[model samples]
Target: MPADAAAWHAWQAHQHQQRQRAAAQAAAARPSWTRRLRPAPPAPVRAATLVAALVAGLAFALLLGDGMGPGLALAALPAMAAAFTAARAAHRKARPWTLAWVAGCAALLVIPALRDSAWPSTLAILCTALLGALALHGSRTWPGVLLSPLGFADAAVSGIGWAWSGLHAVGRGSKERWLPVAKAAAVAVGLLLLFGTLFSSADAAFADLLGDLMPDISLVDGPLRIVLFLFGALVALTAARAAAAPLRWDRIEVAPGTPRSRIEWALPLILLNLLFAGFNAVQLAVLFGGYDKVLKSTHLTYAEYARQGFWQLLWATLLTLAVIALALRWAPRGKPGDRRFVRVVLGVLCALTLVVVASALRRMDLYVDAYGLTQLRVSVAAMELWLGLVIVLIVAAGVFGARWLPRAVVGSAAGAVLVFGLLSPDGMVAERNVARFEETGKIDLAYFQSLSADAVPALDRLPEPKRSCALRGINDELSAAGDTPWYATSLGEYRAREILRERPVTAPYEVCSRLGSFGSRIEY
Candidate 1:
């Protein structure tokens, strides 16, 4: 940021000249082709063609039989009202693509709580909206300013709502551009939906035979729509600000005097996936178990939902922000060889990815065994790092990689990690099998519920390298033996030992995968 502006300018100029030469070469190759197909599509035809596309997209969305059930299609009342709102119409590109978006929402509409089936239909709804948005904005018939926002909400109900906005704004012709790399998420979502539909069908059969290993699939609810709107507002705001600031095309064409700010790229990359993952995680959390793990024992109420909402925002915000910072620093950018402090970041990222996966597996642990903060924190810390790294790589690699952006970032990330781990605190991976033997500690059983069964013997067989807070609490219970003093005495230990001796170690992996407990301890 501080130095090497002159070097950047030289590098940028060279890159721009090369780009011009390539364009010239390609144009020369296609001289006759250019005559047959105008280099730029006409604005009117672009608009009118979209009118037909809107019709097709709407028709496709309506035919989607799963996410939007035939019976509940009428439930799209609120959305239809919003889409057709006078305010919305006045603002969006007055093109047919706008109507197509509304129609997609209308066709893909589902009842609020009746999740129905959300695979291909939802995917279709999303895809159609995206295509319509792309078609509208690409043909100069209209600008994205008036419509991208409502179109976001209207499109989001199908999932990938934010991305649909980005894609439409980016324009279809710019397939070689970096922005649509964001839309790969929409593509991924679509693929997931298609596969998910098959997976669910097979899973249903499997459930009948194997007993529902997977949670029943569910659709995003209305409350989620509200949250998405808020999230979309944030994304739109960020993008709008970026767009409004006139792109010093000169600066971009030639990397600025400042090394291309990776944050310019990294923040959007990390944020997009973070938003998607969090949204889906929330969906899984709510639909699978009815949001009970977050609920206190007394009752299920709006207060509980409200309380959970607070924590969700708190956690998502903290984690998402942390992810952004990590990407900005560790992920690669600029000339192919510029491997700065990347390894340090990768070491941190690898460790964190494992943690996220574990946290996900252990969500079930919380529900069944009352798992607490230690597990949650460790899990999220790991997850945030991993997600931040992966998303950054994929987006840059996929979008910017047109010029090898992804490869440079990834190769450097791996190389940096390998070199750093050997030189410093980072390593490929430290298998603690033996050192684990050296570091032992007393821990509360609740903390171990989600831990592997082998861990029990390991703990019992090792010394107290660290005193677990849970163990301390359990010890406190045993320590005080006054008439009503709280402590786990020999009696408590004896009882616990007996319980442990009789209890089977293995737990259902299904239960381990939910939002709460990983498998702290199984109670039959």
Candidate 2:
């Protein structure tokens, strides 16, 4: 019994020592009291750190917004780099494609700065928004492509969430970091003001120097700048966070599709194909017969016949693209017959659409030939040509290509726009109008005068009276403008000013004098 009692005591003692040792080790490994008292940083606090860095970028972009040139291009870099980095950090798995997407977006945004064309800039802004959607969903289907605008909207919402979350995190830790910084800033400012006042009172020279150095800060302007800073910072931060944490569009539930029989799908497609074929047949006759047949059939003049069909055909082409996209999405793809029917019908529709596009182009050419070429007409013509290219791509992809069709479509559209931008639409409009006037002996001096500086070189090619009138008209219009900042001054306007300075001023001719100024104020 005595031995047993001793053994039990030893066992109990060993267990006590083991518990003591564990408690000691755990206590040693535990965090300090200061850390324990501190609030846990929020998940979105990292986004706050990112936003702080982006504030500097936003300021630089704002500063550079004054001019469109290398400055604008340089301004785009900070936002581009920030977005790319944030996206990578948020989604490491989405690295490869994200890099390409961001790079493409950056290039598109920079083109307008380099080329100084409105169309490219508009396209670039659109492409950038689309890329933001692409970054989030990582899909290239109809839902992804079509819902890009929605995705942008969702990103804005998500960004607000992130910013609020970040602010919460910052609030919780304000005592730790923010208070110190605020206190230091306050002390520094107070000291500067106190010393500044003392020096001003002590020495008139110092006061004069100080007064000269310190700009007159307008109360209204100062507040406006502050407001702008906050606005810009919020926007930049929101975009950064949203890019890092993209909203998934696939989460939105869609209704399950009811499958249709092959006949149900084939009949409509067949009817549509027939309608398109009939239109194409008529178009062929009209195109082959020239504007004469169009005038005869419509019982109208060449301009009326051409003008009426151009807009209608453009709408038809756009509607056809949408229809094809929908058909591809919901049409029966499970059965061989259905697939074959879709492929054939869509292919034929695309081919016929190409014919329509060609007819439209022919009509636009006739109209431009009769009337003078304007920016709208030229842009529309370019679009018509692009539509034809899209149709050809659709036909080729449907027939021969199997994969990457969406990418091909996107690339082709982008390529077309890039080519058009490089072509310089303003210059083309000027050249074509000048050439037409030269041949037809009908020149609208007012129209030529209204053209931007891109048309200057082309306008300079005209004969003496026309050249002098055109230059004078443009110079008069440009010179009468109200004061504008350097950033607001476009490349076209700058070049036009240069042209005006370089060329000699010519007195108004009888023709130039007879036509009164189109603008309201007759400063001339």
Per-model TM-score, in order, reads: 0.25, 0.72
Tell me the deviation in Å of residue 88 in model 2: 3.5
Per-residue C-alpha lDDT of model 2 across residues 1-524, encoded as one tens digit per residue:
45644564465456446645655566567665423322221134353344454553555444443435444555445555555555565554665655556656666655555344466567766776566556544645544455645745555555666566556545544254467766896899899999999999999999987875543335656555565455555545545655665544434445646666677766787888899889888877766887676677679987878788889999999898888766766678776777777788788888788888888888888788878788788888888887787777777777786455655566566666666666677778888878987798786767665565567778888777667777776666667763334444556666766776787547466656665324332211
The segments of candidate 1 whose C-alpha lies over 4 angstroms from its true place after superposition are 1-128, 131-340, 368-524
Q: In model 2, what is the error at residue 9, expressed in angstroms?
A: 46
Clashes of 1: 32
Off by over 4 Å in 2: 1-69, 91-96, 115-120, 157-228, 253-256, 287-299, 396-413, 472-490, 504-524
Q: How far does residue 242 in candidate 2 sit from its true spot (Å)?
A: 1.6
User: How does candidate 1 fare on TM-score?
Assistant: 0.25
Query: All candidates' lDDT scores?
Result: 0.36, 0.64
- Residue 521 CA error for candidate 1 (Å)? 25
Local accuracy of candidate 1 as per-residue lDDT tens digits, 78-197: 223322331232243445644544444443332111221122234434443443333333222112322333433432342233224333433533334434555885799899778766
